[model samples]
Target: MGHTTSTSVSARGRSTVPLLLVALVWSTSAVMASAQAPTSLAPAGWDAGIKLSEARDRNPDPSIVEIDLTARLADVEVAPGKIVKAWTYDGGLPGPLIRAHVGDRVIVHFTNHLPQPTTIHWHGVRVPIEMDGVPDISQPEVKGGDIFTYDFIVRDAGLYWYHPHVMSAAQVGSGLYGALLVEDPADAVGVIDEITLVLSDIGFDSKGVLESADSGGPAGMVFGREGNYILVNGKVMPTLRARSGAPQRWRIVNAAKSRYFLLDLEGQPFYVIGADGGLQERPETTETLLITPGERADVIVTPRGSSGGTLTLRAQLYNRGYGSVEYRNVEDVLTIAFSDQPTLPVQTLPAVHRDIAAPKVAGATRVDVVLTLPPAGADGKSEFRVNGVPFWKAKPYMATVGETQLWTVKNESKFAHPFHLHGFFFLPLDEKLEPIHPMAWKDTLNVPIDGTIRFLVVFDERPGMWMFHCHILDHADGGLMGHVHLGPR
Candidate 1:
């Protein structure tokens, strides 16, 4: 899904010891007289120079984080003098960052001020059924001027995200998503410099007007609509100041409605340490990181270049289906400008490891899900199907609390689907039906076209209706979606 080419770019030699980057030395006395933000620690605001406005914690207790969230239309300038009224949460594209530590409680007082009804789905978080935010299944959609409350506990530490569940594709593509970071102080990853990146895109016409969600009709929906403009934390081609050889931990989330991200940082290797559910058993290195829609990647990178020079971080062309990359060009996601300081000595990354046991699949219940896309109907409408039937005409797959199911997801269509399951994580299996190496938990995975994906998921004691669908929101809305009942049907 990505280009595989690696080359050395370090301007100096590398060492095995950790080299702490020194603080910036300012010479201007007038600027020094004013208050100076800490330059030693990520220079106050790090990656992309687009600092996400964080949600305010209204509560006084340290263990509980509460914030008021609102979904409405706000004018946002993605580029210089290029402004558009976008659907946003709390008047910002990419919404406010919600941060909390493991075992902390999160309370979100949500209000809907948009023209349509909406609900906030906490993607990848292990919230209870009542807090899952699925309309008609967990709760009804909050209409305009309506309010709702979302309260959940952060059970795992990872990079997760949130967006509207109703009209998901349209809402998300219109830019109504935000990042949620859960931290564990006990995490063995010794790297302290980390930044949460919310990767997404939005479609707008050349005249600075938002494009119609249903722009290309059924065929467009079939191929999945991708924004013409690529974005990083809601900014277009933002700049991140970096010191060559300084390592920075990045927790990245792919929040695009359908687009996939195949990131390449000047062909440098990325030390991947974790996925959807957090740290894996061990770290692995890869030249290009392919993050499908709704997936997350935890990686460590050491920028290497000449001082005062720059490198471009590009999103290589990824072929998700027909015409995906046929005419599309590589997009510049971010610019890494090396600071004036001399390159810090390249240091060996810490030995990061976790002990994640493989899930037992002995006699697990078997479920077959086939994703299909037939020809257009008489009305000239195309519909993607799961198990030969669209969601509206399908029955819910049944399971019980404490039941384990081995799902064989076969994609018979011509496009890839990022399969996602709500409220739980699963272990992907290999051809031998064994857990993949460096076992990590995942709730979303890309099922290649005309291929199959098998995963084992245990329906824990949380009983209710959960959703399973394509993370390509357009496909899901077109019918490639279904429900799983964890209780009596």
Candidate 2:
């Protein structure tokens, strides 16, 4: 369940006042748990199984393992006598948590049990080119009842995720998603009482049935046909028990296809210890956090004097897009019941690494990417073009061996585009004229509406054609996507 928007006014100057008031009200609402009712878990005896595929982790302890992706129909008593179709992994929403060391290898023997073709993309994990799981780009789609194996090395240790890269909007929105945790061996920084939260919004018809796919319709493109149900760890109104005064780490990933989450912890101070790639410069504390789809955050919350009480996790409503669809004061996202126990000792947080800097754009080649919409009467077409040519055009976006390049991405539309590059992470030269977070090493960055984002991107790792595109599923499907080739890098 979500929260309601606040109606308080700030006493500060007009501009800052609205933001402050919103934050205060949002935070207060977020910390207040719902007293209405708890949803029932899926009943036993529902069975669905898929082969566990294999992949590798590149960061901490390099080893190999397997993962399974399958779904089942279950009776979930969300309301009295109500059951819904839940696309899941191992038959459970939120699936099973896949944890590994930094350098371990993950092999996912994925079998498609759904009626359509699907493939899993390990979000944020850098792996072999063939194992990246973008259908047609890396490997063929796993058809219904067909099996495919994905093997890759986990290059970075952080809070990451796995979801369908094929027909992502339909598959992920149906709940074929889960969290992946890669821990650092040497310094077990965030090992205490960790919790994983996969945040997503579900859309259902008046009869509670999920809407079918639309082949490039405006309704599908803009609002993403957002779901009426918001789930955390597969449960509506879920709660985790934590000891009072304990320093708890929450690994939060926004798995929604389009919705952006502005999480407010009800004035309770917490530090953002990690981002999509990994740990940040130091913990930055705040009351509210904004995370778009495909983004991950590892935050630390240290309870104050209020132990043996409940802490609510709520979502604050803001404008849905560039226009006026106000969505303020939503309901709860999750809740935590604190027990009366001594607070655990606070461990020393890792320092942000400045040594591994992004290549400066001064000595790099320049690449211009123009995101274009399909022309009129193109048969319900939504396709992206680079340099005025669709992806099918002959010439590839190629770079010389070991060359650093400046990528200037121009968003021609009014929607925010979270651009993602495969095989490498780049630093945003400027995000809205402000420098990004100090320890920001990212494979995905959100480009604001009608704005340009310049990134000093380097291609020094491998030689292959890699994809770069808006992480928004509908936008990407509609041709707001491209790929780059690293020649003998």
Top-scoring candidate (TM-score): 1
Could you give candidate 1's per-residue lDDT for residues 426-481 as a string of tens digits?
Answer: 88998788988777789999998788999999787678999999999999999999
- TM-score of each candidate? 0.90, 0.78
Candidate 2 residues lying further than 4 Å off, grouped into runs, are 1-62, 71-82, 206-208, 305-308, 320-324, 340-355, 372-395, 431-435
What Cα-based lDDT does every candidate model obtain? 0.83, 0.63
Model 1, residue 199: C-alpha shift (Å)? 0.6
Q: Which 10 residues in a row give candidate 2 its minimum summed lDDT? A: 42-51
lDDT of 2 by residue, 1-489 (tens): 011112211111111112235334422211212222223111121111111222333334334546655654443433344455767777766666787655556766677788778888888776656877788878899888898877776656677888888888888877788888875432235334556778877666656576665633764675444566777765666666666555566788888777777788787876786678666545687898877778888787765435567788887764435431454446798766665655556644333232234465567898877665545344654455556765566366888656888788887755677788876666677754333655555677777667788877667555667887666676666666677877774
- Name the weakest run of 10 consecutive residues (lDDT summed) in model 1: 3-12
Total backbone collisions for each predicted model:
0, 48
